[model samples]
Target chain A: MNVAVCVKQIPDSEPPALDPQHHTLVRDGKLVMDESDSFGVEMGLQLVEAAGGGEVVLVSMAPCGETRGLRTALATGAAKAILVSDPVLAGSDALGTAKVLAAVIRRLGPDLVLAGTESTDGYTGTTPVQVAELLGWPSVSFARHVEISHRALRVKRQTETGYEEVTCPLPAVVTVTAGVVEPRYPSFKGLAAAKSKPVEELTVVELGLDPSQVGFSGARQQVISVRAVKAREAGEIVVDAGEAHERVISFLEQLKIL
Target chain B: MDKTWVLAEQRDGTPAGIVLELVTAARGFGSVVEAVTWGPGGAGAAAVLGRYGVTKLYNLGDIGESLPGPKVAAAIAAQLAAESRPDAILIGATHDGRDIAARLSARLDLPVLANVVGMDASGGRLTSEHSIFGGSTVVRAEFTGAVPGLFIVQAKSFAAEAAEAAEQRSLEIVEVEVPDTGPSDAARVVTRHEEEHSGPKLDEATVVVSGGRGLGSPGNYALITELAQLLNGAPGASRAVVDAGWAPYAFQVGQTGKTVKPVVYIACGISGATLHVVGMRAAQYIIAVNKDREAPIFAIADLGVVGDVTKVIPRLIEAIRARR
Candidate 1:
């Protein structure tokens, strides 16, 4: 049960930064494995572990050819990683990012592909499904639980009404939602071993992906503009009095329907 | 014909609330508003949708009472591949809607602007305004294509209103062509359960009370829910609590979860993480109770109480009951 997990190295920011030239996320600064992708990595590692023998591989695209984010996942039991770093991959939209991931994944030829439902930064929530399409595989998105069998995978797909048990054959894509499983923290021994693990770095050319088909030129959607969210103007701050609950009641009463 | 189409979601033979809302929102795009629906119960929804200015309806016929994701996606692609393409296709930001949009975007090779709050076409092109970064900022995106723009608008992004009797028009039901063999044939729901949640849904509730990691454990989450029940509000959880398995994902309200804007929101045991703030900042009135005085939630809280939720929530519930 070889698994490939798609991870994104996103900037760690209170409010994310944008590259002025590209009007996209500024990725040159400190990068961490996107919190969302951690679940996918954790899920992949567990699936491989449950299968008794196989490897968990991570795939990520970042600027500066940074391995910081990849190291974090590698520490959490991923056998190795594939980093696709190039100036040409910058400003790639969801679809372009999916293309890069799908290409790298094809090389690994993993039996299953896993990804986060959406990244916290861009939050387009489309890349996983796009990767499935690019690979011509069935996708089960918003999965809270997935049981992988020898020949098939059953997913507890989340929905507004609750969950649906959806099954698909092997070689499928599944996107795990947040808190699907508690991600394991990298242990001291795991961290030390990760330092020596092999991380295969590749370029678009190596993956047979056209550079022009990615980055700013390949992007279907344009930012057009980026602006800060209007600061939520603070209204009132009250220290808790002994009768603070009364204050809340009075506040509701002021609305006249309380 | 010149038109825009809306995917009308339905339940139990009646249109889902989002369908009527999308119909009202679709009115902004064009006058010849059409609708498409799958399965057998769509006929009952046609008149309701017509009241909201849907002039034509595309029925994909019966596929039973299940979410036929691939079948619906292929059907819509077949429609788009017809002699004429619509100006735009609007779908709600629901789970099934996202699934459909993802598949159609792949099958049709079209771009889908998702989580859209609003859209307009003034400069000879349609641009969607997305409320990103937790609705703090807005990004306006224009579809490059000449026609058949795809957008998955968030629920309640627009107000739903009834068209005047004179404005109401008859809708034409056109049969749609669905692929005879597809993913739906093999997929079946083995078991399904709607969570037995009390009060309204966190997204739909007029009042929402939420908890966070500060709640300590799954047992403590009950305090948040109890207060919510007292207020007749929905109980929501921050991503931390939801991710910690303290509460169900459906209870999560954050950037990654559902976006909720209730009349009044009560945050208990929450540190006011930025992601959590984005989802609930739209509330008309916010009351945050955290032991940490400097929790970021205070910045946005209309009234901030620096205290322990364990101590405050019980008292607050008592206060409400006493007042009643």
Candidate 2:
């Protein structure tokens, strides 16, 4: 079995301040791999472990030096790391991003691919399905559990109501949710081993991707402007304990709730 | 002149609420809006679309008897390609909608904008509006590439238009031969488990009363339910409350759960995490009651009551009953 886990480096959700001018993430120079993607990495590792003998490949598309995230995946038991980096790949939207990933996966030729349900930064929740469509492969989103046999993959998908079990053949894509598996922390020994493992760097040109087929120019959607939400004016806090009871009654009556 | 298409979702023969909302939005862009439905035969799906002012309705008959994600997307994509080229296409931002929209975008080789709150078209370009950074910021986006721009509109962002009485006219239902997609070979729907509680759904409720970890345990959820009943609303919980087994997953509201846009959202014990706020920030009015005055929720709340939820909720419910 060959498993490929797609990871993305996103701005922390609780950023101190998103750059008001550029509409780009003002990381304060602090960047980390998306937490949800870590769950996918763990799921890939579990599948390989269950199969007894297989390769878990960690694939990521970030700036050249940002392979720190890929190295971190190697620390979590990924056998190898593949980084797709290029200067022209900046500011790519979901579609452009998926196109790059699909091209890379086509070259790698993996039996199964895993990705997080959504990236923390984009939050579009469309990458996995897009990649599957481009690859002409079956895709299952919001999967909570997955069991792979020789030629079949059984998965339990989390829906609005409950869970749905579905089985698909190999050469499929599965987008996992956070509750699927607990991600493991890098141990001292694992960290040492990761430093010695091989991490391959491939440029867009080296990967045989046409420059015209990637980045914001190739992206179909463009963001015109981004502005912070307007703050609301503070209302009076009913502090009087004796009058608090009466105030509550009056408030509910005013709103017509009573 | 090019027009826009709205892929209206229907259940049990009737168009869903968000379909009318999307129609109302498409009309704002000065484009001819077309409603398309795919379902079982004799479903009366087209008649329901007429009530929402859907001028052109396409009912793809019995393409495998069941409308799975991939088959429906492929059928619609093929239909659009054969017909007049649309300037933009909109879909509801539901679980099924997201899946189909991504596939459709790929099949059509178009760029997709997901979770759009609003849109505008000018000079042969469509600009979409989205709420990002946990609803703390709003962004306007457009595609500089080509026509038939694709987007998925967020549910509950726009109000559904009321049905108006109009003369009934016969609509042409174009049936397309959808290839045998083989049961979504991608993913299958196994079972749907309904929550035990029979209260109103949190997303559709006009008022929602929610509790957080401060509620202590599952036993104290009754207080939250009592307050919801008093207000004729629904009961909701934070992710922490759901993870602690105090509430079913259906009642949880946040980035991971359902996003709600209610008239009033009352928080009992929640500390107002950004993840939780994104789900409820669209509420018309917010009321936060917590012991800590500095809780993050107070910043976005219209009314803040600084006190323990156990003490405040009971008194608040009693006060409402007395007023009644």
Chain B TM-score, candidates in order: 0.92, 0.88
**B1-324 per-residue lDDT for model 1 (tens digits):** 257789987865698777788888778665478888987787778888889998888888787544566778888877777757888888887877777777777667677788788777665467788876656678777765445777888776787897889979988888887875343334455777677586787778988989987777789898888888887889999888877878887888877677787999888888888778777887888988888888888888888887767777778888777777
Best by DockQ: 1
Can you write out model 2's per-residue Cα lDDT over B1-324, one digit (the tens) per residue? 257778877766777677878877776676666776776642476666666656677666554423256777787777876877777778987777788888887777787888788777766467888887667778898777776788888777678774456533454555566655543445545555455466677788888999998777688899889988888899999987875668767788887787888878888889999778888888888888877888888888888788777777777777777766
lDDT of 2 by residue, A1-258 (tens): 889999987655455455555454544344677887998999999998888878899887764447666778889899987878787776566777788888889988998999998887778888888888888888888887899987688887766666667778778899997757879999988888899888777887888777666765667555678777786555657553533546655666577765
Candidate 2 wrongly placed segments (more than 4 Å): A12-28, A238-250, B41-43, B62-67, B122-125, B163-170, B180-186, B243-246, B314-324
Which docking band does candidate 1 fall into?
medium
Best by lDDT: 1
As a whole number from 0 to 100, the lDDT of residue A258 in candidate 1 is 76
State the DockQ, from 0 to 1, for candidate 2. 0.53
Pairs in steric clash, model 2: A222-B142
What's the DockQ for every one of the candidates?
A: 0.56, 0.53
lDDT of 1 by residue, A1-258 (tens): 899999988887767765666567787788888888999999998898889989999988864689988999999899999999888887777777888898998888998999998887887788888777667777788899989886688889887767888777778788898878889999999999999999888888888999877877776677677666767666666666666777778887886537
